[model samples]
Target chain A: MFYLLGLGILCIAFLFIIGLYNLDFKYLFMISAPAEKITAAVIIIGILNCIISILFFFGVGYLREAVKAFMEKKIFQLKTVLYFKRSGIYLSSCATLGFISRSLAIIYLRVDNNGSGFGLGYSSLLIFMLICGLCFILISHVLKESVALKEENDLTI
Target chain B: MSIYINLDKVLEDRDMKSHELAEKIGITRANLSILKTGKAKAVRFSTLEAICEVLDCQPGDILEYKAD
Candidate 1:
């Protein structure tokens, strides 16, 4: 949760700094017009992301528990695998949506006849999205490895 | 990194089922299974204590030294 919150704050702060640097106050305000809308969308998406992250964390626990359960010939705990799969789905969608939103913002800036500043803003947003996308990919890989390890342990036991 | 668990042999010697041991030790069968399979990263002293108490044995009876 802290990581997500920190990332969100950092992204917003970076956007604000870029906006200030470009003096694209008008565009910023124009973007702000959709601020509530974008925020609403992000809020919904963020909530979903939160839920998914939580499920992912719990999925690890479940996987461990399931392995033990299976080894003892006890009840199979499917919750971990289910939660893990769902988290993967949710994470992918979130990343895609984030990329799309960033792309749309860049496109909006390109078409707008504001100033050269708009170009800078667009580039900054693009870079930000790229960084974020890379981070998410790395995170996904880490999660995948963890899940694989748990599965391997389950199989061996 | 290579702690060896002798839980299987202990259970065998005691003629106690894993589920029964788990119940006696106040842990879920799943957790006991983790311990038995050596998948657990760490074991609490309290849990070890419980297991020893239930099995009427020492920690060495359940765990062994294994140089990694």
Candidate 2:
């Protein structure tokens, strides 16, 4: 069910944060830097990752509840619709913030701008999340229209 | 822009109460009230048929269009 899926996504995001903490992006930077600068970059990246993780939690939680409502045949409820919309925004923010954080870390280390992770060859998880978030938003729009139509149907004598 | 119900006028002419017509048509007085007040978004064909049969009136006699 979607509730389990949301939990899975949250776990994956947590693992992603841990992976980021242990990752050696400096090797990719391939440039010598002061210890303080390296430490600062790592700390900033960690903070951004934590923020992203928090947003992910909120997003996933809302998604879980929305899916629960949907399963209960309440998909057109305005609250559920708004929950989905908020979930989409939060999920998308996670991806965008991740891109910015990692890119900034790379830029800070390499003193260059070759750190963007949006290339086709890059890992697809962020892009996938972004697409998924957009899909949720689209679903919210469809549900909103369905709500109006359903009201009309119910009122029909 | 919306539908207008003329059921009150027909009921008046037929000297039949709304409750009686609703009972004869097998619908609730609340729903009949919705129809009478023109608050209904639509009138289903089945209910229209029942109402027409009960009131001995055509669908047009019970519903009107009031362009806004």
Best by lDDT: 2
The digit string of per-residue lDDT tens for model 1 on A1-157 reads 6467557756664653454345334434544676554444444434443453354334334434544443565432344344334444443443455345444444544434233543345445434534544554454466567667766665332
Off by over 4 Å in 1: A1-121, A134-157
Question: Cα lDDT of all candidates, in order?
Answer: 0.57, 0.76
Error of 2 at A135 (Å): 1.9
Interface RMSD of 2: 0.6
DockQ of each: 0.05, 0.73
Off by over 4 Å in 2: A1-35, A38-47, A110-123
Clashing pairs in 2: none
Single out the weakest 10-residue window by summed lDDT for candidate 2 chain A: A114-123
| Top of the candidates by TM-score | 2
Give TM per candidate: 0.41, 0.73
User: How many clashes in each structure?
Assistant: 0, 0
Q: Report each candidate's C-alpha RMSD, comma-separated, in the order given.
A: 13.4, 5.3
